[model samples]
Target: MDVNKTYKGVALQEVLTLLQQHENTSKVIAGGTDLIIQLRECKVTPQVLIDVSSLEEIKGIEIIENRVSIGAATTFTQLVNSPFLNNGLEGLKEAAKSVGSPQIRNIATVGGNICNASPAADIIPPLLVLDSELYISDINKSRTISLEKFLIDKGQVDLKTNELLCHIQFNNIKNNQGLGFSKLGLRKSLAIARISVAVWVEVEENTYKQVRIATGACSKLGVREREVEALLLGKPVEEKTMQLGAEALKTQLEKRLAGRKGMEYKREAIQGVFKEALTKATYLSKT
Candidate 1:
């Protein structure tokens, strides 16, 4: 295919204008890590490329009134190094750090990762546990949708061709709550995750008051383990309770991925992933 035009150094407004003009023929590029690969493999052939990587509208992290808003273009390296993410949002930090290598982390934006909608994308599970919402904007209008809802299927998302993902926001966990993430990959470095879990827990005097669990790479789309979360809610935060919760998560995974290749291995691997995430979340809550 042939490229009709490439626009760089454009602001968000101009980018939207170009997208409106080109419609389906236009593609946005931010940190081009994934888009470049798709282009090279002939998976996508856009006549126009709008580079929004440096747009000031989507390049930083902000905290306001107990909520954190991350610009869609924020890189994994930026997330990993943010001081604000060091405390209550450690799960997100861990997930960002677990991405690829330093080079990929530096170049890959969170929006790109989410828009790619890869089941194995490390950032999605943690964001899901946080109940994150994405802000999508187009020339005509703007709207917000939950990250879970925004992700339609593997390699697909609920985004219009002319829309851009602007920001991701989630409430900050309170002192009584903690978030934790764990992933098992084939290799330690530069490896795609085989199984990953993110857990958020609220503890009240040794009992689990509220719980949210999300898993990645174990299903067609990264999803919250609502059954496991319900089973763990109001239960004591102890070894037995955690073990039971893990088992429930395994059952959910088995049901969702039945008869698929590698289902058996993923079902078994989820136990460890859930355990690690739960243990860390519990430990963090206590502190």
Candidate 2:
């Protein structure tokens, strides 16, 4: 990771100014868990590195007017220990805990995870189900975009040359609403996900009133499974109904990954993953 210049950012405005000046040559780094590896591998070759690890404006998690806002630089360990993420939002903690080991969790930023846009990122599926939004800024302008739209494709996003992702925001879970996450990895906490699912649902009298499903490692990027969500919505939360929903997801996977090497296995694996995630969501809604 050779860089001609590095700046430790002290303020948001200062960082933006630096980014404007170095637009094409600078990369914003928080935890550097992903960026450093990219740099070493020559996947990215920014001549200047701007360190925003100390920028207070982008380094905490808080609830603002019923919306949960996480500073882009907040670490996975922070997410795991946040009291505000409890109640029906335990799925976020579960996802954060599944990211690598403790050492990696200690510094891996949620913003970094999203910015890297890894198809198998452990944290993305859960965030996708939350319908998260990103706040991005440059020297003179700032904008907000839905996470789904912000993600253009694998290892790519809608971010501009000088813009930085400042934070992520989502609605807080309410009564009868719950979110659940489940991942199938080659090795626990070490290997990337083979498949992962996250479900956010609102249940009423054992029926699914509203449901959103997101999957990782099943496509070019973590994506919402709207077809499966539609299949489960307005349906009774019975084992048989849920099984049918899983079958629907399997069918969707079959079409999406047809002719791919892992298509058959993923088509089968998604059923169990979807069922487990939906089960947790329904149980949380009842509690």
lDDT of 1 by residue, 1-287 (tens): 76779998448888888888889898889999889999989899998898988888998899888889999999999999987764767888999999999999998999999999999999999999999999999998999999999989999999999999999999988888899999999999899999999999999989999999999998888898888888998998789998999889878878888989888888888999999999998888877
lDDT of 1 at 37: 91
Candidate 2 TM-score versus the reference: 0.98
Q: Write the per-residue lDDT of candidate 2 for residues 218-257, one digit (tens) a residue.
A: 9999999998888888999898888988999999999999
For model 2, the local distance difference test gives 0.92
Quickly count the clashes in candidate 2: 0
Residue 280 in candidate 1, Cα distance off native in Å: 0.8
Where's the lowest-lDDT run of ten residues in candidate 1? Answer: 82-91
The collision pairs in model 1 are none
Candidate closest to the true structure, highest lDDT: 2
